[model samples]
Target: MKAFTTLRTTAAPLIDGGKLMANVDTDMIIPKQFLKTTERVGLSEGLFHELKTLADGSPNPDFVLNKPAYKSAGVLIAGDNFGCGSSREHAPWALLDQGITCVIAPSFADIFYNNCGNNGILALTLPQEACDVLAGQAGGGNSVFEIDLERQLVIGPDGAEHHFDYDEGRKEKLLKGLDNIGLSLQQDSAISSFEAQRKLATPWLEKA
Candidate 1:
């Protein structure tokens, strides 16, 4: 997991005009076909495959992610109920591969939100109006949004600050680049001590 403190980059909008696209499920983020691999690196090829591809198998030029200006976007201004279905961790993996480190939305599915934090991606919940404003700015082209996780602020292109709330424990883990495994390792001494005590108490079990 990468430490996430601050990110200053362009934002991509998953909005249509003033309305944000709702109920963007994990399958929509990365379709079933892309779930074959356990490795996270190459999943970007399947990120939003259905929406970004045409019937003829060509890239949809109209898609916000496919557009020239947003090709390198690092933040996503998404919709309400984003990441709404399935408990696939690959959704955030694909997003990370596509260079999006943070996602802003009005709401998110519980599992998906947890997965984002576990995988080092920031899933922010802001008011619907605030999301709409950021989406509008992102859709306007050549806009840069700065996300300061330490300060819990999202600075829009026009310099307006939008505050967001996050779980303190999750925030600390993200800031320190600690995943579940990493967090577990932090209790190494205690774990080792317990193992040693168990081994001494159950010598017959070890022999068996």
Candidate 2:
């Protein structure tokens, strides 16, 4: 996982679901057909496949991600309940591969929200009105958004700051770039000591 301190980049808005445009599930983020592999490197090609691809397998001109302005967007401004449905880690992997390090939404599914933190993506929750404001700015295609993870603030294109709250532990992990494995490694000395003691107490079991 990469450390996430601050980011200043373009945002891609995915707010066209319908009504409240909520529940943009994991399957929608990366379709089932693209879930065949466990590797994360090439998942970007499959990110939002159904929505970004045309019936003829060409890139959909209408899709926000396919648009030239948002093609390299590093932030994603989404609708409510983003990352719902099945708890697939691949969703965040796909987003990371696509160069999106931050996602701003009104709300998010619990599992997906944690997955984002684990994978170094900032899954930010803000008021629905705030999300709408950011989305409007993102739609302009030229506006830049700044996310300060340390400050817990999202500075909009017009220089307005939207404050957000986040879990302290998760926030710290993201800032330190500590994934589960990295966290485990932090206890390496203690683990080694425990293993050495166990070997002494159960030499016969170790041989078996």
Name the best candidate (by TM-score). 1
- Tens digit of lDDT per residue, candidate 2, span 88-122? 99999999999999999999999999899999999
TM-score of 2: 0.95
lDDT tens readout by residue for model 1, 1-208: 8999999999998866557889999999999999999999999899999999999999999888999899899998888899988999999999999999999999999999999999999999999999988988885568889999999999998999999999999999999999999999999999999999999998887877
RMSD of each: 1.2, 1.5
Candidate 2 local Cα displacement, residue 71, angstroms:
0.9
What value of lDDT does candidate 2 attain over all alpha carbons? 0.91
Using all chains and alpha carbons, the TM-scores for the candidates as numbered come to: 0.96, 0.95
For lDDT, the strongest prediction is 1
Q: In candidate 2, how many Å is residue 33 off?
A: 0.8
